[model samples]
Target: MIDRKKIALLICERLLMEQEMLRVNYINTRDSIGFFYIDNLLPVAIATAIAESFPTSSEMKLKKSLKEDKYISAQMDKHSEILEEVLYAFQDPQVVNLIAEICELQDIYPDEKLYAGGLSLMEKNQFLSPHLDNSHDKERQRWRVLNLLYYVTPEWKIEYGGNLEVWPNGLKAPQVTIESKFNRLAVMATHNDSLHSVSKVLVDKNRCCVSNYYFSDEPLKSSDTFHVTSFRGWPQEKIKDLVLRTDNFLRQTLRKFFKKGIVENPHYYKKE
Candidate 1:
């Protein structure tokens, strides 16, 4: 069984080797939805082990609504131990600090509770509509600074449709698609304007990702303000867009009156 320390070591070594190039890519995209991805992030054997250990769709919790459709699980103990090991490896101090330096960010911290973080799987026809992630952590204490997604499904293709879509120029403009390639780790800066989504899955296979988010004492951008995870439909879906907009507005409004909202979100780990 791979442990967090070993996984973190492999990840740090890979990031250090590609540090310069990743820095450049991130800087160039900083004006938009700044991000970078590293391929072959781990040894093929280790990557394969992690990928193969993923829990089936039924073993995870399904999140289905107008905003998104996917299977997610933050309850690490309920699934394969490798999944939890890989997930927390990204949270290791050395790994987190190294990633922050590459992105030229400071004061960033990893989420231990895995709020909206953990394992995610998308099956046929499932999708996450374009939206900004909720700006803060569970307690609304820290600003969600970066989104770290490590795709592990072997040979997942671009045409399969479960790719990461960045609407850097806004929803009406042509969005950038980041393939959910195997053994690739994608890190993206998240702020008020960092709008992104997952394209619908078109094939029968599952697209699996080990996800984590880093938070900070301050916002990524000076102008960023508190907001809910706002969702919007594709440009052509006028009615859906309107409905989603209204939904976003209502949720945002509720947050103002109730700092944490009416109910507690059940997506975080409940360690015993």
Candidate 2:
């Protein structure tokens, strides 16, 4: 297991020290893709331990689609004690409050149910297509305002692919590559235009990440509107792009009528 209190304390101190710069960075990007990151967010030892705690890919659920190809799980009870602790450390009230302050967001809350916020593993050829996350929480009550992705796979490199790509200027323009570097904590604002995706993994090794989302009573931007998770293929894959766009359209249309949808999303952490 891990010491949640100790971890939260460490985070509070570091974020407090960088609060000004972090806020500035986020504000600067608020008009665009809207994101900021911190390298070596936790001690090297803590980061390494978290990575080591990752379960084998086979132990997780595979989600293969035109939108994404990866393994993810919220069934924390089946995982390590260290993982559950580390995952929720970011959920600690003080830590959550500090993050909301840094991002200049108000009335925010952490998702204990961890909807699409848990462990993700991607291997060679897997990728997440450019997309906007589902705007609201499971019940369509809270808006998902921010995404916290902590990459723990040691020695992951940009050249190795599986990097985070942001289309701030849209797909016609080049993407800004944010390496899925080891021990890096990336926080991105999520709304209608926060279009992003994970580049395809090139090497045979797995890219591991601990993910979370913070919800708010309000959308990140005044102009932000509601939408289902929308996806588009990478710029060059025209046929795939057409297919995905159509697919996203159909799903989104369905969501318009069925607010919660006919079938509930089984991706959430189902507490026993």
Error of 2 at 175 (Å): 1.1
Clashes in model 1: which pairs? none
**lDDT per model vs. reference:** 0.95, 0.90
- At residue 103, candidate 1 shows an lDDT of 94
Cα-based RMSD of the predictions, in order? Answer: 0.7, 1.0
Scored by lDDT, model 1 comes in at 0.95
TM-score for candidate 2, please give it. 0.97
Estimate, for each residue in 33-55, the C-alpha lDDT of model 1 and write its tens digit. Answer: 99999999999999999888999
* Candidate 2: C-alpha lDDT: 0.90
User: How much is 76 displaced in model 2, in angstroms?
Assistant: 0.3
lDDT of 2 by residue, 89-126 (tens): 99999988988988888888999999988999999999
